[model samples]
Target: MDIVNYTLKEYFDQKKSPCLSFNVFALDKEHEEDEQKWHRSDYFQVLLLQEGEVSQGIEHRNFDLLKHQISVVFPHQINALQMGDNAKGIVIQFDEVLFCSDLLKNELISYNNDLMHKLNHVALDEETFAKINHYGVQIFELFQSLSPIKKEQIRFYIKIMLLEIIEAAHQNYQGFRAPDELDYFARFKTLIEANFKSKRTVSYYKDQLQITSKKLNEICKNKTGQTALNIIHERILTEIKRLLIFSGKNHKEIAYELGFDSPSALNKFVYAKLKETPSELKQELSKIYKY
Candidate 1:
C-alpha cells in the first residue's frame, strides 16, 4: 500500500517560495483521485464545498459536507475526500509559515483551541456563505495576479476570511460560554500528542500542565467526556490504528516504535482495550480498506 504524503513544496507546484506558498483551486471530477486518497499534508487547508455533497474522513471520524459548508483540516491529520461527480468547491491551502506572526497565530489559536469535534464542518447561512465566498474569490484572484504587494494583499484577505469564519463558528453555538480553563485542556491535548509515546500517565500531564490530576481529569471529562487517562489511551489507540492501516510495519515493529517493551505488551494492551489482538485488528482493517 502506498501512502500519499503531501509535503509543503510538493503541494505548492513544487515551489519553495514561502511568500507565494498558498494555492486556491476548484474541486471537480477532473481532479486526480490520488490527491483525494488518505494523505497527510504539512500545511493547513480550508475547503468550501459549494455545489454538491461529499464525504471526508479525518483520522477515525468521517463527516459529510454539503453545499455552503466549509471544512478545516489541520496539519498532520490523515484525511481522505470523496467528491460527487457534480461536486464544486474551492480549496485554499496555505503554508504554516503564514501564521508565524504572533498576532495571527494567537488569534487562530484562541479560536481553534476549543472548537468542538462536531463543528469542523460549519454550515453557513446563504448570506454568510456569499460573503465568505466573495472573500475567497478575491484571495484566489490576488493569488493569480502578479501585481506588486500581491502577497500582502493575499495575506490581508486570508486574515479577513479567517475572522469571518471564527465569528460564524462562535455564533453557531448560541450563547456559547468557553470555559476559563479551556486553555489547560488545549495544552493537555498538545502535550498528549507530543508525549503519548513515552508518557502515558495522567499525572505526567498534570505535572507538565501544572495542574492537579483531579483538576485535569475534571477538565478532560467536561470537555471530551473522557477521563484524562482515557483520553491519553484513545490518542495512542488512534495512532496505532492509523499505523496499522497505513503502514507496512508488522506488529512487533509497531510495538517497539510505540514504546511498548515487547510484542506481548502491545498485544496485551490492544486485546484489553479493543478485545482484539493487533493482528486480528489489522486483518479486519485489511478486509475493509484492502490495505
Candidate 2:
C-alpha cells in the first residue's frame, strides 16, 4: 500500500493490530514502481533484505540496504522508496500498541519505549535473519488466525516479536547512543516532539522531568553528539523550514503554529539558527526538493 496518504485509522482497519503483516518476494521475479509517498503515523517498520540491493532513506540518510540486512523506520519519519535495477525484501509493519492494550506497562514504558525511540537501522546475518523471522512468522500466523477478541493474543505475539526486534536491531547496530545513556536521550527526544512548540527552553524540559539542564545536556550529547539546546534549535528550525517550504502559510501563520511570539521573533530565530532569512531558506529548500 502507498502509505503516505494513509492515516493511523486506515492502517488500523487494514492490518487489524495488534497485527503482523509479512510478504517475501524475489528481486528477479517481479517489477513494480511505487509512486505514492509513504510515511507512518503510529507504526514501526522493518524491511528485511532478501537479495540484490536497493537505495533507501531514513530521516534523510541514504542507506544501501542489502540481503539479510534490515532497516527500521519509525512513525512520522519520512520513508523514502527503494529504487534500483534490483530490489528485494520483506517489509514488516506494526503499531506501537501491538505490545499491550494497557499502554502503561513498564515494558512499554522503559526499555521497549526507549528502544523504539532510538531509531536504529542495522544489518544482520542469515542466522540472525532466521531467528527474527521465526518470531515475525509467529506473529504473522497468529494475526492471520485472529478473530476480534483474539486481538489480545495477537498483541502478546507481537510483544514477543517486538522483543526479538529489539534484539535484532541492537545486536551490533552502530550510529548513535551508548547503551546506558540511550533511554535518557530517547525520552528527551520524545518529550521534544510532544512539547517543542511550547517548551523551547532547556530548563523547561529539565524541570518537566525534574532533572537539571546539565544532566539533560550530558545525556543528549553522549547519545547524539549534539547538545540539548542544539537539538532544540534544530527541531524548531526544521519545522520552520518545513512550514516555509511545504506549506503555503505565511510568516505570521508559521510563527503561530510554531508558538513564536510573532513573525519577527520567528524570523530572528530562523536567521540566528540558519544564517539566512526565512524567505531565502524557503527558496533554497524549494530548489533542492523540486520533485
Candidate 3:
C-alpha cells in the first residue's frame, strides 16, 4: 500500500503554476470527496468546521470535531476527513516558506508543543467562532480573486487566525507557563528536526546545544514530559513511520537511508517502539485506508 503524497500545487489544482504557496477551498461535497482518502501533504492545513461534524485522523490519532471547531494539521502528518452531509467549513493550506519572513517557525513550534497533549481541534465559543468564520470567508474569497495583493492579504488573515488560536490555547492551559528552559528546548527541537535522519544520540544533541546530557534531559522532562533520549527516539520513530508508509522503498533501502546498520536493526527498532513489525504496521495501515 502506497500513501498518497500531495504537494501544494497538486492538492490545489494549480499544477500549471506550481509556484503558488497557498490555497483555500470550501468544505463542500466536491472537496470532501477529494479529501476522503488518507494522504499527507507538504503544507500546513487548517479546517474550520462551522456546521456539521467531522472525524479526522492524524498520524495514529483520531479527532472528532463538532460544529464551530477548528483542527490544525501540521505538514507531513497523515490525514483523512469524514464529514457529515451538512458540513459547512473552509480548508486553508499554506506552504511554510510563505511565512519565512514572518519568523513564524519558532512560534509554530511553541504552539504545537502547547497542543501536544490535547486534541488538535479547538472548540470555539459562539462569538469567537463567528469571528473566525468571518476571517475564513474573507480568506477564501481573497484566494479566489485575481487581486495582485491577494497572497499578502491571505497571509495577513492566516496570521490573525493563528494569533487567535495561540491566545485560546494560552487561556485553556492557564496553569501551564513557559518554562525558563524554553529557549534551550526549542533549539533542541529545531536541531532534532534538522538532524534526526543522521543523528540520533542525546549526547550529540546536547553537544550541539552546548549543554550537558543530564541538563538536556531535565529540560525536556520538565517541558515536554519526556526525557531528551526519549525525544530523540520519538523523532526517529516518526520519521521511520513516515518512510514506511509513504516512501515506497524496501526495508533495506529505508534502513540505509535512516542510517541503520542493517535491516534487522530497523526491524528491531520498529517492533520495540510500536509493538509491531514494519510489515505488520504497513498492513494495518493498508486495512485502515482501504476502508
Give the candidate number with the greatest TM-score.
3
Clash tally, candidates in order: 0, 0, 0
Q: What are the clashing pairs of model 3?
A: none
Over all chains combined, what TM-score does candidate 2 have? Answer: 0.50
Higher-scoring candidate on lDDT, 2 or 3 = 3
**Candidate 1 residue spans exceeding 4 A from truth:** 13-19, 107-110, 116-119, 173-186, 189-206, 209-291
Q: Estimate candidate 1's alpha-carbon lDDT, on a 0 to 1 scale.
A: 0.73
Q: Candidate 2: lDDT of 283? A: 78
Q: Which structure is stronger by lDDT: 1 or 2?
A: 1
lDDT of 3 by residue, 170-264 (tens): 56654564434547876787788778778999989998888899999888765544688877887677667656655789999999999899999
Please give the RMSD to the true structure for each candidate, in Å: 13.2, 13.2, 12.1
Q: For each candidate, what is the lDDT?
A: 0.73, 0.61, 0.73
TM-score of each: 0.59, 0.50, 0.60
Per-residue alpha-carbon lDDT of candidate 1 for residues 30-144, written as tens digits (9 for 90 to 100): 6548557887776668888878888888766888888998887765566788897778878888755453344544455556545644245688998898898888888777767
Candidate 1 positional error at 9, Å? 0.9
